[model samples]
Target: MGFNRPSRIQENALPMMLAEPPQNLIAQSQSGTGKTAAFALAMLSRVDTAQKVTQCLCISPTFELAVQTGKVIEQMGKYYPEVKLAYAIRGNRVERGTKIQDHIVIGTPGTVLDWCSKLRFIDPKKIKILVLDEADVMIATQGHQDQSIRIQRMLPTDCQMLLFSATFEESVWKFSERVIPDPNIIKLKREEETLDTIKQYYMVCKRNQDKFTAICNVYGAITIAQAMIFCHTRKTAAWLASQLCREGHQVALLSGEMTVEQRADVIQRFRDGKEKVLVTTNVCARGIDVEQVSIVINFDLPVDKDGKTDNETYLHRIGRTGRFGKKGLAVNMVDSQYSMEVLREIEEHFNKKILKLNPNDPDDLIKLEDIHN
Candidate 1:
């Protein structure tokens, strides 16, 4: 809502998306580029608030993403008092055979599928707009892909479909073709995948304890409004959160093991600036936009199951900061040989250098802190 200018993707994609004859769109852009706002405006513009019969639907891969998207729409449509929104995610209950009368509905694929197929809460025939956030994840996951396709099949032929994400693979394209027909496409070059506003750096630590010490040094020296630390595993996240907590830092932890409501609550607290540091696994990697997050710490470099460098995850992790034209910082801690290789590959893939930082030096930490400001 503080957007002073339209981002590149928004400038090019909005006209087509908000046309009189609704159009389908498939857009690819880096995080912090106003992709969600673009789609949210389109969804709001298309909804017939006068009728209030679930005229528009937005689907995301996770509860957090769906909730985030719902918040955007809510903020954008705040003046439109007649517009009502409903979340189809878990814990949002509706009785059997209950009809949904909200103007906009948002939720995860499985829950949205249940509301459409089993619950019959919203009539697909009445929906005029459909949006899928984080489409690459939506299609690559088997269960999500199946449920998304099933939900698409139930929609009317004229329903305007929109898909937004940071990456689009060959498989995702194939899946997009199936869900959307003749969509206007918007894509960025490979080199543009990483954000330029976020100053990047790396500090090599000989041991895990050294990494923790480095983190303490940085936090002790800098006045970070909010920082997100990403770990390779849930165990690492829990340990780091506990360690930070013991050090008297207001810390919050999030991972796959936590329930949907618990995860949402943790994120809410972080957004409200109740936590100074948030330690997490990959759950908050994509589409979690917290504007106050000025620093993103890669406590452990991201790698896939086969130990391959996940460039997309790295981009998303850093993208959490540097949001909406704000200067931010991303610091990577290389504690092992494998992590060193992972960082090197990520550097080469993005063609960006990660400057060396001396964690023990006060001057070096102060410089790192200034990069974000």
Candidate 2:
């Protein structure tokens, strides 16, 4: 609501979403581009204050994202106090057996499906609009396709649908076609995908064990205000966080295995500047925004189950920083020949060369400061 102007995605997609005889929408843009506000405003506009039943349903991939989206909806709808809001995320305050009387419901797909099918807490027939925030991640990482489809089936056939994400794979696009019919699509070209505000770099390590040493050296040489180190697995994230903590670095570990409360607390601590670094897996790669994070470290480059390069994951990981057109840096640690090849693939995909970092030369580390300035 405080925004003075619309972003490119908003400028293009918002008008179509609010147009007469509402049509489905599929939008792809970089992160921190006000995609949330765009969809939130569309949902708010469609809601009728006189009706108390759940008219708009917004589903996110994670509990943290659902909570965050709920806050955004609340803030944007501050002028409309009569529009009740409810969240169906884990640890939510909505009491059991209490009919969700709210006019709008924001939640994870699984929880929203459970409440609709099993608990009967939400009346799907009353929902007039459906929005999927971070749709690619919801369908790809969380395996929410089946649940989301089931929930959609419960809603009225005429309900409006909207899907938004920063990156969408070919497989996800096929799924979107079946979920959203005759959609108005807004997508960015490959060249426009990666954020220009980020200064990307890579550090070469002789072996996998040398990556830890290189990470420490980079941390020691650079003056990082706040940063996020991404790993390939929860085990690696935990190990790296412990190693960094022992080295007198303020660090926090977050992964999907932890309880929702623990994850929320870790994110809060990182956002509040209580933690200097957050070590996490792909769980935080999407829908989590921390403006103070000026740097992103790929302790382990992302790869698929078959060990192929995952370009979408790579973009979202770096998108954690360089938020909202702000200057940022991303450092990739390449230890093996395979990892180097993967890094090469990422560079080629984005059509940008990642600068090399030399730990032996403090001058290389100073380049980060220069880029930020």
Candidate 3:
């Protein structure tokens, strides 16, 4: 009901689930394509006002996503006044101690598991629908497998399950097969080779330190409203954010080290236009959407197991900008610290030329208007 126009996933899977015999559903779609609404609508349709002891449980990978999903539910459920909804976070209260039987419960895995064990908040046996958002990331993030399996065990034998992810690895698919009953599978056509919306560029530097000078020059020349700088680790993110702040840039750092509240607040400030730049690791790379990000700077390349730029991670990093058919820019800083082969992989996989920076000529730093312009 929200978009009026169904997403690719909803166009193919929603009708089948609503019309076909009751069966578990596995829907996979890239992020920002409205996969959240697909499952949210399905959960709302099946929820009954009379019986509400947590009929539907939605698990998200990050607190930000959990909160965002909760907000979406609030807006979508305005039509259904009788439907009561609540969210459980890592440190939040579990809805009135005495189970009011919330119609829908949205939470992260750790917090949800704690409440289920400590507060006896949600009786999974009463849950009729289960939706796991960002299924692949849930598996990749550690300390969730045991809790997820335990949560599955608590659910009723016949309850319908829905698993969604942008990238479906073999291990993640295998995990779903073990839990979900023989179910219908839907994979939307992913923009596999490269992001069409982003005008990607890369610059070669003499050394790792020179990369920062290149970024600083770009920073000085461009009037970007907002940007995200991706680093390899939390330490580097903090260092870069601090360095930019020293240069009179309004920047904030987000890494796994910071508390969840801190990260959430920083993201909100960035969204509010108070922060000009956010330097962060790849941790927040997936499923975190902030509009008006004109550029994405890869200060440190995302390397795979073989020490190469991971195509999926790079794609997702650049995908942050140029979203929803908008023009976006992605700049990569490469130096001798990384093998030329890695740079070659990025260009080869993306099927585009990587630009180089000329430090002597300041004119090279000028921002090009939109590609079409």
- Evaluated with lDDT, which candidate comes out highest? 1
- Each model's C-alpha lDDT? 0.87, 0.85, 0.77
* Most TM-score-accurate candidate: 1
Work out how many backbone clashes candidate 2 has.
0
Candidate 3: regions farther than 4 A off: 1-4, 95-97, 191-194, 206-209, 220-223, 304-309, 337-339, 349-353, 357-367
Those runs of model 1 whose alpha carbons end farther than 4 Å from true positions after fitting are: 189-193
lDDT of 2 by residue, 1-373 (tens): 5688887888999889998888899888776888888888999999898877889999988898987888788999899888999888877765678788888999898889988988889889998899988877887755598898889888888899998876678877977887888899998645344558888999988765677787787777767888999999888898888888999999999998999999999998998999999999988987788888888999899999999999888888898888777888899998889999999999888888888988657788677667756
- Give me the displacement of residue 287 in model 2, in angstroms: 1.9
Task: Give each model a TM-score.
Answer: 0.95, 0.93, 0.88
List the candidate 2 regions with Cα displacement exceeding 4 Å.
91-96, 189-192, 207-209
lDDT comparison, 1 vs 3, better candidate: 1
Give the alpha carbon lDDT tens digit for every residue of 102-218 in model 1. 989999999999998888998999989999888887775669999998999999999999987778878878888889899999886453435677789999998878999999998
Model 3 gets an lDDT of 0.77
Least accurate stretch of 10 residues (summed lDDT) in model 1?
Answer: 188-197
Error of 2 at 146 (Å): 1.8
- Evaluated against the true structure, the overall lDDT of model 1 is 0.87
Scored by lDDT, model 2 comes in at 0.85
Report the C-alpha lDDT of model 3 over 163-219, residue by residue, as the tens digit.
887777798888788767887898776665326667777777766567777778877
